[model samples]
Target: MNRNASRILAALFGVLAVTLPFFAGDYPLQVARNIMMYMALAITWDMLLRSGQISFGIAGLFGIGAYSAILSVIRAGMPAWFSILFAAIFSGVVAFVIGFLILRLRAMYFSIVTLALGEIFRIIIHNLHDFTGGPEGVVIQKGVIFGGNANSLYWLVLAGLAVALAASFWFEKSKIHFALTAIRNNEISAQSSGIDIFRWLLLAFVVTSAIQGLLGGIFVQSYGFATPDAVFSADFTLLPLAMALLGGVYSTTGPIFGAILLGLASEWLKLKIPYGHLVVYGIIIVIVILFMPQGLRQLVRRTSHSADGRSA
Candidate 1:
């Protein structure tokens, strides 16, 4: 679509999103919250993917943030709101330190390390039984944020989604886009062209990790607890990855579209085939990868181009 048309549609969506909880019932709002969380995670995943590095550490950073937020509240006596921000900051700092070491690796080497890191984090949390509540997890004694109000909770998650969207758009529109595209297209060429490849990669990694943590914090605060299995669930990593892939990678709009479709479908599957939903979900993802690897965005674009050619 043209710039003006895109803006108008975005504005309409924004209005609808902001006003959703006001009119919609709690169930719809809850569904929207879940979708927004995964959408944010998917966007963050794509952000890192732009640098030609595939990461499997979404759950690690997410679980870290979840624990950080809850622990800050319970141990440090931090206010619920401040704890969420603490989660983001702590996760960003951790990513910054870890990036220096792992950013040097590329491709599957980097991907494997990231995946291992998530498991390592979970194991560490498991051993810290006294502090982290071990496998049983920790709960917020003060109750959930915003007094467990569904509207407020919906808006909180929406705010996290907005942050992710804004950051992704910024990456897309600014010089970072050129830098990341160059790095992804060719690291050697990007380096020769005076792009600081490592710096750009690190920046993307840190930013995305921080956003994942922020979403995690929001998630834990919304539910009033954090468990290793729950917060660091494979779903946190896999669902977002699948959503990004199914919608289209390397763009902001792709994840949004993917998350909405997959998220709703997932909810329905849970209701219809709760015990085997994930198996069905995995089958769907496999079908998409095999048959529609380029995802809905590319498919739609190709269709539009063909229709235009026919008309012309």
Candidate 2:
């Protein structure tokens, strides 16, 4: 797309975001916030995947952020805003440490290690009864940066989405893109060409982990409570993975589109099926992967091309 088209689309989205609260009630606004949050997470996850790394530790980083924010509030008596910053930093540090160990593995081995790491983090938190409230989790007792309210939480989530989106866009335009593409295409060749594959991969991992942590902080604060199972649930990992895969794994826009579509569907399905909604989600994921592996973005591109050809 051209810069003009991009600017126009962004302006339209901005207008819609600003006007959303005005048109929708509190419940709908809350749903919009959830959708945007997951969209941001999905995009960040895809960003790391761009470098040919498959990370399954999103829940681990997210849980770390949640616990960090909660503990900062309860133990340190810090302000909510400051705690969020601390949570992001803490998650990034953990990611930096963990990246070194797992970045050496490739494909399924790396994925399994990350998944195990997530479980390890969850079990550790679960065992820390005094600090984390064990499996019971912690009660936040306050709202987000403000105090307590839906609109405040909505704006907080919007800010997070904005930051994540901007970072992803910057990565696409910077040398990170070349580094990631090189790493993805051929690590040996990339290294021969002087690309620090390990360094770039580690950087991507840490950055994505920090964003996941930030989102977790927002999520826990928004709900005014946190639980080990809730924060470290497979839902967080599976939903974002499905969203990215469904929309288009490698492109930024793909996850946004997929998240919006699947987020809404998942919400509605919960009300309709209550118990089996997740089954529907799994089915959707399977269908998308089987039929449109390149994602809805590719489907749309193909349709546009066919239409243009017919017109010509």
Candidate 3:
């Protein structure tokens, strides 16, 4: 019964999202787009996390996508939409190459390397001033991907979110989930059970990186600019990580729930703290880890179980 209610709620939300621009102004639509974009990022993060690997390099691939698409448009004379495809493929290829080298690292070592790589990507872009516009950033001469139409741009981001959601759901339904679960529970057991650990891990990494790159391309094309600081900001890494953690680490619905709640509040928080919002984000992460590591999903389930017990 609760599952039915959740499905109904999701349907209603989808309807509202599709019809939003009819009554809402561009600002509200843009805000919704921002939420959807971050939600996609959070979902992609959790997808790779399912393999028991923690990655802090979302901004790395994201920035790669932004620059790759935009640079292709400018230097290679590709259309903006075509550049998005190139961005995804390029990011996936980079991930595939990098995964071969780094996936062998265990636990926090892998995490720390990813964090370093995010900054490394940023530094490389910052130094390539001749083509990339360096730290000053590049302003694309191209118009927005959807001709700057609020409704179209909103739908474009929504489509990307839909794809991420579909992929997450598909992952949940596939044997890959079991393999990843076994891996997360015990790599030795998984290996003994015949799981090719490195192959699955590499697949997850490449797929998630591609999705992140896809979103980044859409973002840069829509916004009409990309700078190293803007694209590779720690906010990209931290906020999505927070949303995924707050929502739920191993489920599709958790990140969606977290992103909507926190993404909405984040703008206000940034305004209030200005220079100190990252501190607030850090505090939230620490609190969630200490008090509710399973996140709001666990809380919801407990409430539902308690109500059932009371009725019984």
Candidate 4:
């Protein structure tokens, strides 16, 4: 799409998003907030995937941020705004240290290690009874920013989505795009072309981790409590992965589209089969991977092309 068209579409979407809660009821607004949060997570995950790195530690870093934010608020009595910043920094530092070791690995090996790291984080939190309240987790007495009402929480999540969208757009448009594309295509070639593959990969990892952490902080604050299982659950990592893959991994629009579709489906599925909704998600993932590997975005593009060709 042309730049003008893209800008216009984005503006329209922004206005619609802002007006969503005004038209929708409380339940719908809550669902919209969840969709935006997952969209942010999916986009951030795709941002790192652009660098040829597939991480399973999204929930780990996310949990780190939640714990950091919660602890900061509970222990130090810091303002909620400061907690968000602290959580992001904490996740970034952890990513920097972990990326050094894990970035050395490639593909499936890297994914496995990251997954293991996530479990390790959960176990650590589970055992830290004094600080984290063990597996029970911590609760926030004060509400989220802006007094923690549903509308306030919805706007907070929207702001996070906006930030993630801007960062993703900048990354796609800047030199980092070339660096990550090069790395994704061929690390040797990228290095030969002076891309500093490790540095770029590390940068992507840290940035994505920080964003994940920020989202986790928002999740905990919005709900007013956190537990190791809830914060570090595989659901966070897997759902976003499925959303990105089902929507299309390399493009920004893919995750947003996928999140909107799957997020609503997920809610309805839970209502119908609360215990088996995950099974439905798994089935959808299987079908998409097996038949529509290019994702729903590609399917739409192909359909549009066919229709245009027929008209012509």
Candidate 5:
């Protein structure tokens, strides 16, 4: 019964997401796009977390992809559409090269390195004045993809999100799942079990980095510009991390649910308490972490179990 209900809900959501442009206003579509983008990011973050590796470099890789896409279009004369693809490949390659160096670091050591890498990426871009337009950023002379049509732009981001969702689902269902779970549960045990820890961790890092880069490319193409500060904003990392934590980690549905709730709540807070909204938002997140560390998914499961017990 629960499985059937979930399928029905999933189908409804798909229909609504696909048909949103037809009925929703431009503003709503824009907000939906933002939510979807972060939702994708949250899923990718959780993907890596499944390996017990927490990355703080989501913004770094995302920014790399954003800049790569924009620069390819500006300097290399690549098409806007193709540049996004280039971004993903570029980011994946970067992760693959870096993985050998950093994937060996476990726990907070890996997390700190990832965080610093993002800062390093930002600084490099900041100093590249002639080619990258320096800290001021660069704009597409040709303008945004799709001529900035809101619906078209929304769909572009949605497509990126769809890729993220597909990859996440694959991770959850494949042998990769068991590999990561074993690694997370006990790296030593996993190693003894013939699971190459480095290999699986590297794969997760590369795949997640690639998706983050893809999303960044989509963002730049949609907006038609990329600034070091904007593209490398900490929000890219923190918000998605928070969303995944809030929704629950280790599952695709967790991040999606978290993003939807927090994304809408964020907009509402901004409108109602523009000056203090961030403070309130942070407080809310802290409270959730303190009291509901397992997140909404786990909370719902507990509630459902309680109700069943009562009926019994």
Candidate 6:
């Protein structure tokens, strides 16, 4: 799309997103909050993917954030808003430490370690019965933010997504973009060309982890509960991964669009086949990998190109 078209479309979407709650009911607003959360996750995942890292630890970091917020409020007597900062900080620190150790590994090795680490995280949280409330989990003792208003909660999640979107656009505009593309295409070449491979990789990992963690913070704050099974579920990782793939990896808009479609489908699927919705997600991943590897974004571009060609 041309710059003018892109600007217009962005404005249109922005207006729609901002005014949506005005027209929609509480349920739709709640559904929107979930979609926005995944949209943020998809964008964060895309950031790391741009650096050529396939991390399956979204749930691990996100759950950490969720628990961080929960613990800060319950144990430390902190406010919910401050707990969000605590969540981000705790997750960022963990990401920083882990990135130093695991970022050196490449390809499937890195992915495997990340996947294992996520399970390990869940296990540890599950076992911490005294501290984390174990299998039963804990509920919020405090009141909700915005006085528990649905519209307020909806805007809050939207604000989080906007931050993620800004971070994504920054990655594209800054020098980080070229550095990551270089690392992705050929890390050795990127290193040879004077890119600090470890630095960029660590930066990407830490930033994405922080974002995912903050989203988890929002989740727990919105719902007033957190559990090992619920927060650290495989669904968190797989759903975001599927959304990113379906929308197209390495692009912000792709994930946003993908989340919009899949997020709604997921809610419906949960009602229709609660026991098998994840199977549908698995099937979607398979289909996207096999048939539309470039995802919906590329397909949209192609269709647009064809229309433009015919017009000319």
**Candidate 6 CA-lDDT value:** 0.89
Q: TM-score of predicted model 3?
A: 0.96
Q: How high is each candidate's TM-score?
A: 0.96, 0.94, 0.96, 0.94, 0.97, 0.94
Candidate 2, residue 193: how far the Cα is off, in Å:
1.2
Supply candidate 4's per-residue lDDT for 191: 86
What is residue 157's positional error in candidate 5, in angstroms?
A: 0.6
Query: Model 3's lDDT to the true fold?
Result: 0.89
Relative to the true structure, candidate 5 reaches a TM of 0.97
Question: Candidate 1's residue-wise lDDT over 1-312, tens digit each?
Answer: 433644686688789889998799989998899999999999999999988899999999999999999999999999999999999999999899999999999999999999999999999999999999999999898899999999999989999999999999999999999999999999888989999988999899999999999998999999999889999998999999999999889999889889988999999999998868788778878988998886877777776667667431
* Candidate 1 Cα misplacement greater than 4 A, ranges: 1-10, 310-312
Misplaced by over 4 Å in model 6 are 1-7, 310-312
Deviation in Å, model 5, residue 169 alpha carbon: 0.6
Best by TM-score: 5
Winner of 2 and 5 under TM-score: 5
Q: Is candidate 4 or 5 superior in lDDT?
A: 5
Candidate 4 regions exceeding 4 Å error are 1-12, 310-312
- Give residue 60's lDDT in candidate 3 (0 to 100): 95
lDDT per residue for candidate 4 within 1-312, as digits (tens), equals 333644586678678899987888889898899889989999999999998888888899989999998999998998887888888899999999998998999999999999999999999999989988998888887756677678888988898898789889988999999999999999988889988888988999999999999988888878778999899988889899899989888878888878888998999998999969899889988999998886887776667667667431
The lDDT-based order of candidates, best leading, equals 5, 1, 3, 6, 4, 2
List of clashing residue pairs for candidate 1: none
The 10 consecutive residues of candidate 2 with the worst lDDT sum are 1-10
Q: Write the per-residue lDDT of candidate 3 for residues 259-306, one digit (tens) a residue.
A: 988887877787788867678778889988898898888777777878
Candidate 2 C-alpha lDDT tens digits along 118-224 = 89999998998998899988886654456667677788899889878888998899999999999999999999999988899989999999999988888877776
- Cα error, candidate 3, residue 213 (Å): 0.5
lDDT of each model, Cα atoms only? 0.91, 0.85, 0.89, 0.87, 0.93, 0.89
Per-residue lDDT tens digits for candidate 6, residues 43-103, read 9999999988999899999999999999889888888988987898889999999999999
Alpha-carbon deviation at 125 in model 1, angstroms: 0.5
